[model samples]
Target: MNERSLVFFVIVLLCAGFMALSSFEMVQDYIKPASGRSVILNHLMKLTVALVFFVVFLYTDHRMLFSRPVIVGGYVLSIALLVVVLILPGGETRTHRWMNLGYFSFQPSELVKIYTILFLAWYVEKNQLFMKRLFRGFLKPLLLVSPFLFLILVEPDFSTFALLFLTVMLTLYVAETRGVYVLTFFSIALIFFVYTYRMGMLNNILRSYQIERLVSYLKGNVSEQVMRAVEAIRSGGTVGKGMVLGEEKLFVPVVTSDFILAIVGEELGYIGLGVILFSFYGLVHSLVKVVSRMQPIPSVKTFISGFAILIMLQVMVNVGVVSGIFPVTGVTLPLVSYGGSSLLATMIGFGIVGNMILESERE
Candidate 1:
């Protein structure tokens, strides 16, 4: 691989390693299997599936994959999967977001994130002139995104829905859509939020547990979960409790998924967390620099910058939620979360960004 490719690969490896370590802790804490073999097998299964997708993403031609028909077909497939998961029978926790396939359960909402990004990128790239049309220009993109957003919201995956909405808005803004149109959309979103709150529609839309989580945040009631997270960080102190010895892992649910950063903070301490954050910040900075340097290729530049912003935004929101600075939204820390679909989708997105950067360099 070239130097840039090497840098990308190193970053991916670092992320994957962090996630794998977190997953191991979760499995140990939660999954009490009859034998050590079974535990190892489960871990291997998850890691292998993620690795397979990572390889596929690394090899795939992102530009060709972003074509109109391909994008539409991907959206259709993602929605179909979501429907299938909703209809399938499983225990309450598993049934809500996953589809069982003998040995594994997959989350459709995870895949939907990638498909939505692909669709938005393709749409915005093709409609550069619409950026000047104000309200008329936004109609097409809005139409394309509306159904997807509705489906995701119905899935009760509001965190992913928020990410999708942010991605669309960012892509549109970067495409040079008028400020008034952007403001108009934000106004509409605010109005919708108020309507939902006043009508108790928000309560209907979110599950009781979800609503409680929101209430806990709004009321400034630090939940047991948040308290446990805080305790984890405190236990870590300056140097951390030293990996698997950390007590926080035993108390925190979904620590390997949504709140994995807390584990890092608990075991690796603030220094390790700071390193991870700095790496991500550096990645975002490099991406922005790449975009700015590509003045000769405005379309590609806009697309890359918008895409990078979407990724960074999700990261920030997820981190903020975990840190108790924002409402808990079920947003997983990108790259560092132990979900197969998320890992694959993120690799694919970064692959596309890398492709854009490479093309720019070639020019």
Candidate 2:
């Protein structure tokens, strides 16, 4: 990374850490003492784990993961975890997105998302010569990625599933997959999605709350959470209510997770939000520059491009939901959200990207 890019990343990381601390303080009143866990403690533990992943990936050889066996193993392991989460009993919300261990909960969809990107990149590079062919290039890649998407969709993680699917398609396009074939596949998929929704097939898969949320969004009946989030942001005006001083945050549920931006808006105002937006743009711009200038390693370039897309997509979705432009997709802001699974996965991907960039520069 260049000096300027490093500065941008550090700014966002510091901002995220500060916001997380403030969020922890805000939620303390609601956390039960009998629960044996504190929000701050969980955030710190997860941040520690994320930092460890960052260091490990930074030092490790990126080529190790480029091996066929290693890529396949990682992909299979992600799939297995996704499947296991479905069979295990869900927590109080009855959402099958998490696997509750004794001390921590892991969201398998997060793992699946990163692994799928790596796997697709490797697969496309390995078959680049035949990538224009219908079966060998287009259909086959989609077929391989289908299981991962299906598992995540069944986990009822629609946002992750959709974003992952989009990322996979983008990777293929970057690796020289035929544009016609890719477009045809996307068209067919869209038709299938609409057909299923009309037939009520999706009703069986989506949870009651998920269905209700979508319906409310479609019918113009915005949910209370979204209303509160918008209200909080609008109430901030030009200057914020000041850090930890906003009364609106008290009414917004999931303020620390999906709607964390609302807190940023309310506490820090437009200046804080503008800083975050610029920082994200800088980070992604830096990554894209690295990908574009790197030596002709299709897999590495594709992976980094997909990673950038993933980050931007999540940020946009989170912002949209908070502003009531989009429905609540339960998508958290990249690096800004309060979940261990999300933070760890993003850091690990960053580590891989850093290693690849360094390796390319050395070559």
Highest TM-score model number:
2
Please write out the lDDT profile of model 1 over residues 109-225, one tens digit for every residue: 776766666776677667666667855467677787687788777767777777888877877777777777878888999899878877878866877677778778878977776
**Candidate 1 structure, TM-score to reference:** 0.86
| Residue pairs in clash, model 1 | none
Per candidate, the number of residue pairs that clash is: 0, 0
Which candidate number has the best lDDT?
Answer: 2
TM-score per model over all chains: 0.86, 0.93
Clashing pairs in 2: none
Q: How far is candidate 2 from the true structure (C-alpha RMSD, Å)?
A: 2.3
lDDT of each: 0.69, 0.81
Worst 10 residues of 1 by lDDT: 31-40
